[model samples]
Target chain A: MARLSSENLETAYEIIARYPVKKSALIPLLHLAQEQDGWVTDVAMAHIAELVEVTPAEVIGTCTFYEMFKRKPVGKYVVNICTNISCQLLGGEELLHHAEQKLAIKAGATTADGLFTIEDVECIAACTEAPCLQVNYRYFHKITHGEFDSLIDDLKAGTRDEIPAHGTLAKVRQHIPAARRAGAVAPTDRAEPVWLIRNRQEGAS
Target chain B: MTMNDVPKIITSRFDQGDAHTLDGYRRTHGYEGLAAALEKTPQQVADEVKAASLLGRGGAGFPAGIKWTLAPANVWPRYLVVNGDESEPGTYKDRMLLERDPHQLIEGVLIACYAVGCGQAFLYIRGEMAHAQERMAAALNEAYAAGFVGKNILGTDFSVDVVLHWGAGAYIVGEETALIESLEGNRGMPRLKPPFFPAAKGLYMQPTIVNNVETLSNLPWIIRNGVDEWNKLGAETSKGTRVFAVSGHVNNPGVFEVEFGVTTFRDIIFDPKFAGGIRGGKALKAFIPGGASAPWFYEEHLDLPLEKVAIDRAGSMLGSGAIVVMDEDTDMVKAALRLVRFFARESCGKCTPCREGTTWMEKIMQRILDGHGRPEDVALLMDTADNISVDFMWPPRMTTICPLGQSATTPIASAVMRFKDEFERYVGGPIELNVTVKGAAFIGPPTRKKEGSGV
Candidate 1:
């Protein structure tokens, strides 16, 4: 069965340690699983379930609820085009059409060479930068047809080194130093909150 | 006064390219609020913010300080969850804050943590915001390294830790309770209020104060300069400057900070320094006073001040501080369909009315847009909207649990009622079906393909 690599397991443990309840780490762990592979596999879900101490069905339930997590295999680059109200007003629909024609695949389909996937997404919070597209979650705001084509060309030719693969949300991972961590003990392990004990002591004094 | 005359409090460091960096932030009076806040007791800090009357910029316009004081007194381990999961259709101010001046937000988070007696704060950014997440994460790490966060911040007794959590693309998580649910590794479905209010019983069954990123970003300025200075700005009820993210058919569509209650919808849309009027010198047909959820406002309503009360009286809200202008050329029917389709897609499917009703509304609107509208289709759209929201009035009476149901009704009700003639034009026989995919944007049970139809 597919599982997180040893290094990824270590990083997963670090993330789980940040939350009081280990289950709170479920989303981040799922992201990590996706990061390991482009799409989340059943075995990866099972692995995350075991790590987060939830059932595979529970994991799948949470996973399916979000729009980002892909169940099936996808291309390396996921091109999400915003076609909501603001973007639509500024030719978002036209851009989506243009992308479909350019890529020779439909909105939800991956390319024949398994390099790119186009999706007509809703608002991605960049309303000001209308008609925006994100390749592997990296933004290309206010893109024209020419810019988009050039971007695609760059992606195909491996010239756009700034953009990463589909699952990589950020190139720079967050690191919390040991001294700075808020005691991420399991909630059940504590009789009462640590702050409560301090508060009680201060009040009594 | 114009926007230039208004002080840029929260967005002070926006133009500074290095504001996201620790050094850049320090050079520009950063962390001064945190310093000022630490000098006062937590109660004192809370009191000052309450006095300042800083309203939440994440839509609802509730006072941030008042929200902080609502938690049961001395509730240990009270959590401060910053709502950076900003995916509102026309809202992007929070995104700018996240990407540009993350340290400012971090400082605000630290101050808010101290004020609310929280030992830990969870910063939930949106999944699609990769740049924002990176900027915020980098800023947070720099802050921790500099001792602004985690364990005796700035050599003071007060210590707070902020965990950076990103959502997996659920707009429903923007709702406070749904955000809490998402934080707890559950499906991002909103829990019913009364028993499940975050202030009373929240994350891990303890008290939590969920604040908008923009709301928290105000804390530093208020704390540094004092409430008197803050009170000098804005109107009587709504105090402080608000970051208005203006978009759509405008010449210069971007985020601008203006003193709240002073500016009008017209000033925001037409002012040279702001949106710079509509694109292509076109006449304004209609504009969303706020985010997509608010009812559309026409040219007559342009004079209304950008105040919560004034806009509310005019039958719409300055929701999420997003102003999307629509020009004369925009097809009202198609525009309504665009927004309706958004609500339907992002309904979260928790409540039956919102899930089913929004889909129905989207379908009917799509059918009309597809030139296959029946004569009664407009009434059908209104009927479906009425079913979702008990009435088409402002502050809609909802049949569903969350406001998402009522939000679906706004575009249809606003568009159909105001421009009945335009909706009528799409009716009768098949007009030019420009849309390639019939009902492709909507989500529901798939219909059988019609002959020669673009399915």
Candidate 2:
């Protein structure tokens, strides 16, 4: 029952224009769909399929393969805590338990109030600052139980201005001027570089 | 031991707060390398890099210069893909470079694009790194405004466009071929080689050169200072410095840029300048020489140098330059499980051996930690690991299409080989240990299809 807004449709068209091939924008459009609707609805996938000139089944194939795109609806803030080796060594497992208790939800469940979703994720590549977690993909490194509680409280109170909703990748949207584009096209009349020809000749001799 | 000072070439501006901006980057000898490179032909620029002998920093330390040449001659519209997908469990240096100093990366991209004759370049960053994506996107916009990227770069005859693409989370996309698949809006599964080598047949089935972020980041310095000056450091094989991210149990757990082939593991882990030794005066039990994929090295191998040949000869690779140290109190069985679980979860399900073998390994490791371990679980785990990796050897001979499948076995082989007693200690019954699998709801025993009730 979800659809991209007129503004988002324009944005999507602009994004597709950036790529040499239309199909290459499928992943980015899926992200845009998620951004517009929180989770990718069936309608949005079919819409994206139409946009990219691929079947809905093909869209599903690419969407399901990636871990970031949520197939089902999640809460506003998706708290992904790392429990891989580095974080595990630094009390990451205990931290997950603490988060579970605080949110009143298990690892893969959404809270009853629809405010938080907890996930025991793989490494977010912030190993140095072990025991790291991300709220809607914004990093809080080397977090403690107290710091985590305050973060939850802030998110619940809607006071954390920096952390946006789920699927919002960045604050700034990229806008490329048409003149600045690389104009990438399959070459038919390109000439061989002088250096390569020289190398080939030198080898022949 | 050569105790020469490790020069900070790529990361010289890391401490500067505003280095991500165009004006700030210009002040710090930033675009000077591009200017120096612009003075020469693309081939001459590539020749300079070959002379410097820069090795790729993304796990496999292949020569970056040689990789650029592998793209067939006159393969028009050959692409340059800059791999910012630093997803290896313990690695995080690329994130720092992307977040703190993006223009330096952009300059590196420009130099590479010009050298390789690519009309378009793709910078693929992993999705989990939101900050990195934002910083890079903003930096790319700044770069385009400054005429550093896009058509007619810097008022010269040369023109190229650099596109900043963020990947949806998939670890296998770190593989070059798989990355290309992901770029093409397909599942991030690796293609079979021989026909799909990125250099020969890549994006849109044209020749392509894929370089790591750190590898390309070295180009500016190499171009600006010349090869002889850049070659002053490092050893016979690895000819430059590398950023080693040290984490776990270490006092100063962070990224450090050190000259390659000079410092040893002992110096990196225990030295005051690096990780500053294990925390709380704890003794070192084991350490992953590279990221989670590399086999664990023990106390005996601490004296081995950080050289590629030295580490390779020592039966583990310095893959991804991520060093994770485990102290004496750390439970080896639990540690092994954590790594195997990562590989299993991120398997991508392209290869059956990888998809099933990693899961099998994880289940066994989980069972061992959960007080339900069978006596034959250790051998069973080893056999499963061997089936995936083909053997318990360094430079692993893999059964799957990519090294990811082989990566699952390193922890198993290393843990069982050295810490067999620890794994054995967890066997036979409900052993109450602090290392219990907390999130058991996610990974439980597979359900048996009730006594052959054919539906």
Candidate 3:
């Protein structure tokens, strides 16, 4: 519902510079928007469309095509469990069921308190570590029921809260020189990159 | 010679100490190939690769050497697009290479760029591979800082820039043109062929050469090892070793590098050295010889050699060199559903057949697996698959814009064709939706409560 704060807009321009064409930055910008909000909100998509000079429909098209971009709001952590052939063969389905029961919700549901959202994702290419799952895109390999239970406990206690919210890319915000030039990228069009020092609260779910 | 006797080639540094680091890579015959390639003309480099007969390690198994050779002269500023969208269900080899030994891929990129006279290259890594992306991005930065990727690499007139792009998560993007589309920041939909073929016209409507991560990763070895040495390996027509991402119902499910025709599905799935036979001594039921794109191979085909010619002759593919094995306890109907679900979700809505056909098959599979089916459902699935590609006619025949139609159809057609009894059992039975079946548990819903859906 809210637009990216002023500081993130500066980061947007810099990301665009990384590509020869600004449109190529769409996926990255969507990632940036996600970092701002827990999911890619409709307003955020519109804002991204303006930034990349594409129609909102085009943004929606690309965004919907991707399974990672959540159009609707999700919990603080999105637990994506790969249930593909490899995962299925080696306890991936059972893991999903376990998570569902553990969280008191089904495969695609978020907890009532909005702390976690469980997803039965496809193969993440980590077949060797069969019962693997990712929390906010960070992999947990060879996971077991006990490990998952402990992880959930850590998440609840905020001990495993080192990772930022579901939408955030990295816990730290970087203010670097522009790729094309040396000048510090000022907040553009009055939008700015949410600096770590200022927006520490934003990363909190 | 046995598989172990063959040169390690690209996968040698897999387990070495700190292999991910640049220093670790350089110490172990890493970029020597780039240095060697820098001394030769682009044409000479292309000729050497062609002579070596290095086929594309991606799904197509096309000649990697000839791909570079096919870059048309009329199009200035040719581009090299590396397919790193390793989303095919069983394939994860590229993820390992990108995360562990990305410098090798970079050196190969530099060589391929030099050989193809291209000044720009883009590695479109899968969105799900966040760690692989981080490693590759870090590796690219190191390569640039070290003067390997930027202007006048190794102090020559040649200058090339590499842009490391990320896909949002479209399996279809692995299909070169769709990759180009996603790289351009559009919905990753496959473009119609003839005019849209990548070599002749691609990426901003310019000539381009798209190679797989493994295909380009092999370049450094080809340039350094010499063509004759490369040719001596592998069966005729297909040269060089490929990294097979073996998973599912095996003792040691992991990535293995092997020469073409040197081994068989039986060896990879059953040999102690490879997958080490199906897990818990379970009887091997079926396997996907390639990634999801290839057809299913049954017990009768276990001895079939893992090669392009052999696989093609058996009516399947060596696609992406991903072999996912299954055991007797697995449900064939549910397995087909898993693959169809993937295809349906990843269809991209670009073509009529792929977009609609995959979804239709998914619905039917869900119904059948949920204990609501008729005898005609099996025939209907095969019939629909036939309409989708009808044996994957090449040169833009009966297929859709890309091979995705065939990819969507392959598993279903092959599964129903090989194991009709399984489908029949599910069909004529009562609607007993067993949510307890571990591997097949995620097949359908009512599995999820409506309002509780996070998205």
Candidate 4:
């Protein structure tokens, strides 16, 4: 299915308008596209390229470089377990092993029904909450085995509604008035905007 | 060293539940700093920051006011980029400030943007910080609606537009130059020094001022309280309270704000007000005094001061103010391996020394952890690390475009030096080679010859 539907186009343009240059919105636009689909697809990448006015290769370069973007289909719920130094010292590795045993699948693998995918990720800057994990970017502080199992059960039963689907980044959308939106200037053009020139500054775009 | 019964700067507001909201922030005297700041000229505001003894809360601990002055004078439209990508393994005070008291950060941003005459600013937050990002984005909208941002901020002739950029998932973006490159829409790889420094030519090729989230977060407090009050909080060389993230094997493993040099590593670990001592009554074996990048410290060095120069003189650093505690049961080799693996994954494949050196060390560490280490491997590991490392010289030499390679090697070197006996146990032995393979099986050293009939 086409990920970036016509309904999302206006919202996409508003996001694009937030940057002085079109390419600067590449990452945010990718978040919007992923918000529409569970993971980034070739079609969605193409759609993003068209929306942001960049080549598909450029979009893919930015997308693949970041670990958050998934190239293939992800499970309904992506359980990202943080196993960096702080968490590792506090049973982060054991937690991952426990998860593997309970799920009957290794990390980076999804269940047969495709409800969950366990990923051993880098630090989320939440070192204070060790043995911590995130499901769809929502924190499950100091997660224990029992809590983990019940969380999986909750996800399987479709009971956890606080967090959105796998690809959704935010609960709120940004709406910029057309007048206040940053009009995109060509990369080749060195011409400055009235506001920038009024401040005696050259536009970095 | 300056000490108080409790912290007065950032942590003073932590008890308030609704501090994240604009109203709650105002109730706690948040935006008053920005209001007080707007009354003065940009240079006057800059002078007040210079008058204070504030050091960058980020690992580097560079003078924040000095950084503001480095932004090119003739260049107009200077940008202020706040590095909210707090991905260092043991460091996380930025996430706390962003989530708990967000408007304070926004107010700080407004003030910093004013001090440097930056018409635009960007908050480059890490991808995993969804809640932090959500709060910050909401705060920005609140700021715009309340006239704290946008055209003619606070009825002053100043106007600045702040952009919130989310990192997909690269730790290298924590570097200022790499952050700028990422904000411009590319891979978050560190740029070569010389011409690519942010202050000289930053985002979109303009003079830029990049500060840490916690560093800028303190600006509001310093601007409101005046320079003399801040200078009284820490050592002669260092000033103000730093919010430290205390994690791993500690009873009260959380963030703590303590005046620099006033508290020792011992106090941070055992003090009742801080981390209530190591968990389970286990003796402390070693600790990562800084984030993962800093060299590990042993139990004997508990008396070391928390000041940057003191810690640096002690052969470690007070990096990012992240104190990761380790108990007697902790495995130094395994811990070092995890750190190297983190760097390997987040290396960004930029310059040779970092990219190749990190992955190479990961493989070597994996072999060592797997009990396949040879007597020569320990020396080999040091050799590999030395190739990427830079000692504390005047210029501070480094092999990579960024400091990632250096960080990747720090743990290995320190762990090996402090725990040489541990490495010896695995030496002169081969791991279970036929070991049941699972997932990406043993991607051995690159130099491993192509064995077996080219099947």
TM-score of B-chain for each predicted structure, in order: 0.93, 0.93, 0.91, 0.91
- lDDT, candidate 1, B1-455, per-residue tens: 55567788988888898999999999989999899987776767889999998888898988888898899875566788999988888998898898999998999998888777786789999988899999998998999988998887888667767899989998889999999999999999999997989999889888889999999998888999999999988888889898888999999998998989888777889999889999999999888878988887776677777788877765678989989999999898999998898899899998998999989998988998998888688777777777777656667775776799888878877777667678878896322221111111121122422311210
lDDT of 2 by residue, B1-455 (tens): 25545678988999998999998999999899998987787878899998888999998999989998898875676888889889998998999999999999999988987787776788998888888888988998988888888877787767776777889898889999999999989999999997899999998888888899999999998999899988988988988888999999999998988888888888889999889999999999889989989877777667777888877765778989999999999999899999999999999888999999999999999998998888688778877887877656557776888989889888877777667678768895322222112111111121422311111
lDDT of each: 0.84, 0.85, 0.77, 0.79
Over the stretch A78-177, how does candidate 3's per-residue lDDT look in tens digits? 9999888778878888999999989999988899999999998987888877889999888898899999999999988888755667876533222222
Residue lDDT tens for model 4, B236-322: 788878888899999998898888666788888998788999888999988888898877776656876688776765566787988
Off by over 4 Å in 3: A5-7, A169-205, B391-397, B429-455
Clashing pairs in 2: none
DockQ of each model vs. true complex:
0.56, 0.56, 0.22, 0.42
DockQ for candidate 1, C-alpha atoms: 0.56
Q: Scored by Cα lDDT, where does model 2 land? A: 0.85
Can you tell me which runs of candidate 1 are displaced by over 4 Å? A185-205, B429-455
Question: Which pairs, if any, clash in model 3?
Answer: A6-A191, A6-A192, A7-A192, A7-A193, A8-A192, A8-A193
- Model 3 residue B319 CA deviation (Å) reads 0.2
The TM-score that candidate 4 achieves is: 0.91
lDDT of 3 by residue, B35-104 (tens): 9987776667888988887889888888888777676664565677899998888887999899889999
Candidate 4 runs further than 4 Å off: A1-3, A174-205, B1-6, B390-396, B428-455
TM score of chain A per candidate? 0.91, 0.90, 0.82, 0.86
Interface C-alpha RMSD per candidate, 1 decimal: 2.5, 2.6, 10.6, 3.4
